[model samples]
Target: MAKNNSRNMSDQSSMNGYIKSICDIMRRDNTKGAMEYIPELTWMMFLRILDEKEEDEHLQSEAVGEIFEPSLKYPYRWRDWGSPEGKKRKELQEGHMDDFLNFVNDDLIPHLKSFEEKTNATKRQKIISQIFRNLTHTRLGSEKNLLDVLDKVDHLTSENIDDTHQFPLSQIYEGLLLKMGEKNNDGGQFFTPREVIRAMIRAVKPDVKHNGEYATFYDPGCGTGGFLAENYTYLTTPEISDLKLNASDYNHLKHDGFWGLDNSFTAFPIALANLVLHGIDQPHIGLKNTLSGRETYMDLFEGAPYKFDYIFTNPPFGGKEGDDSKANFAFKTGNTQILFIQHIIDHLAEDGTCAMVIDEGVLFRTNENAFLQTKRKLLDECNLWCILSLPQNVFVNAGAGVKTNLLFFTKGETTEKVWYYDMSDFKVLKKNPLTINKFDDFLMRLHSDKEEDKISEKSWYVDIDTIKKKDYDIKAVNPNIKEKEIPKPDELIKIIEESQVKINESLQKLKELT
Candidate 1:
């Protein structure tokens, strides 16, 4: 999808202002927190976008002399309940506001919820039913506020500006997710920064056309489907256009190429809405704790290790998988990261590639049997190709202080050599966040031969013999940067004396005051 329209700051601000107005309505209505506002806003946006798309498709069908079978009945359609010219809006303005809200509460939602019961429902209908099933209109205050919010939503067009390349609904949706994570109370646990998602996608380079089969990507711990969405864009971009894919190829790719799982009750709908707004008519995101094993989607994975062609994710950290989930893995670890690592290895296709972020503890913790066994299996079964020690500030907004590394590897090849890139010194702040350009040199080096790939003092490689002797610890230690020497006791005393005079002067001044 080539974007011929270019969006300037003014267009973005106008749309953002609209979003801000919606949030203001929610806040005024006492919608409680970001948790409430996010879901509320997402569902509203989903309906609005869906209606616009349906109308366009219906017109096209009519133009081609085909009957447009609408997914919703006339009374349940967005134009019926959501548009300004609709009966509901006219009644809402004329003091039948409660009647309109009652219809939405008692009638509209129930109709939407019935999609799951239809034996012949399409994937899109099922997805709609799943989202509404998990959703509730909690703490939405008053009908007046709802009408006000609906009016603001009605102002949004599918495409903002036609000539100047204004932001589309997709960008608006992405921005809202970012806002939910950044300014809302959610702490964005389900949202990985876009920069990190793109980097992981670039590293894995998943291609449906090149694979000669129905290529797929999975994120076992998909928080709001960031990795999966980024991967979808990668496969459809013009850079991969040389494959000469037609419309049906893309249609297949959009519906089947992505799979995601998450345990969050809150994240499921958000992820579904995110994917739907991004033109994935039927997203394959399911609700499951990647490690929980509590519920199953036998239809999708066939009750076995459903291997995907590529696996890319940033699994939740600073938590532990419970005993029941731990029982499912060979390593038998309570650690969440380790269990996800094992799960990915088991479910990755024979030639599958995976790029994930892991806590630094997984790289150096040799005390636990589970950890050691994980490292052993990773080394023996896969070629662990690269490690990038990321700067801590990269995840500071997520409250992550533990040093993390990006691990890229493929199955069915024993490790021979591993490239290490030390980016600890790379400064990143919230205001000056990491960007795709920052990883340009690293990505270039990633594809080149070892001899030609050297970038600076931060890049190096460790052979398999060295790794084996070190017991498979893959932490990057830059050989090029010389270590600093510690001072002797006498030198330490001299350093203390240098600061003692100022300390004594301050103490004496305090004594005089006393």
Candidate 2:
């Protein structure tokens, strides 16, 4: 029967079931009713999964064998199950799973009448009992059934679980992404283009060899954890064509490497859910403003003396005007992008590499807004490795066609020449509707690690001294020029001849009518 049901039900149906189960809880609670508010749902689902896992014979047996038994007496079991005061107590203790379960199941459910007179909402009390009863009816199947589902979930063999679960989670995240995009929060800053993200990740290429013995990864502006998740995906090899499962080392890395920080109360939970859903066990996520100069926020880097081996991000840009008063201490300038760049540079390990997407204004602006100084500092202090000029219409869906560039750099070495790849003419990425087209060739070129072929039309290297002389203006050094030009008289005569032919035709038509 289970096999038949599993076979008949589509993946969409199963996803809907999960979503409906969540919605039912939300409707009852009257909390923010969107799934994108993932923190609330994440906490609930974590408890639900724990309860389900506890009830499983296989997991329970394993739990007994493991160092610690599942905390059965605390969080998993519902409290006040059969009590008259159940409803009143349930609301007060909704999120406090451990204490509520212990008190209600062990004490109140057994001695319900004693508490009934003290509780408010007698009808709600009755409803609460019924809800608990209903909850018990919802079964996640036996141990064997769960194991089968887990097997499918664990089918990814890539080092990054993000790619493995990207399909399933993308369906979940798209709804949230669209909602966040619509809100226009932080100047529509929450949304980061995936192709651009992929490009950054591809450029950095964080791997075991590059990261050292125990490399740490972090993203201070970890929106929905897209940067972290993409980094995770790139590190892992995709499932082989003939292989049954996608291959990955994400779990191993997460246990040792991954960490993130975000300030958005809304985005924090989504980021956590993203990491967990991607199979990172106990993701080390924290909530703090990356732009905060406070010692408490900066203390996150205390233990990790060295900077990250590789960092990739698309920090919020052009939202600096509203809250410039309390910007980071490291940021002497008013520009938010420059501040973030400074922060990234400060946190970087001496040997670390980084790639960041920034507004085009950061490149060419010669004003005294500290923009030129910041540019000078970047060139002088770090190895300004490469800059890829991304195409316009890349972020059209977000209602911005402003040109952007991918700035790649490293901490220790001073760069002599900066590689410049003009992807301005590159086609847009299809899945990313915001962008015109993805520059797969650019990524391929980076991956190949080859030097410039002077003959190649789209790419070349520029001297740092020349860029510095130009005040770091890295626009199109070479533009496509037409081989020939039409003379003015000839062009005018051609236009006149076309107009005369049209007039002649009109006259002949008039004659016919007469």
* Clashes (N, CA, C under 3 Å) per candidate: 3, 20
Write model 2 residue lDDT over 157-253, tens digit each, in one string: 1221223244344444444444444433442466676767876776676664453455667776787777876666556534411112222344456
Off-target runs (Cα >4 Å) in candidate 1 are: 1-13, 92-97, 159-167, 239-244, 296-305, 397-400, 502-514
Worst 10 residues of 1 by lDDT: 1-10
TM-scores of the models, in the order given: 0.90, 0.66
Prediction 1 TM-score vs. true:
0.90
Q: Which candidate is the best by lDDT?
A: 1
Instruction: Provide the overall lDDT of each model, using Cα atoms, as 2-decimal numbers.
Output: 0.76, 0.55
How many residue pairs clash in model 2?
A: 20
Candidate 1 structure quality by residue, lDDT tens digits, 1-514: 1122334324666767668778888999877566678788887888887888888889999999999887776777777788778875576557654777777787888878788788887667777776787654434658878878877777666444332332266667777777656633464677777887787777766677435777777889887777877776666665532355578778876677778888777788788888887777767877777787765332333333378888998877777778889889998888998888899899888878999988888898887888888988998899999999888756653565677889999998998988888888877776767888888888878877767666578898899889878876778888988889999999999999989988999999999999
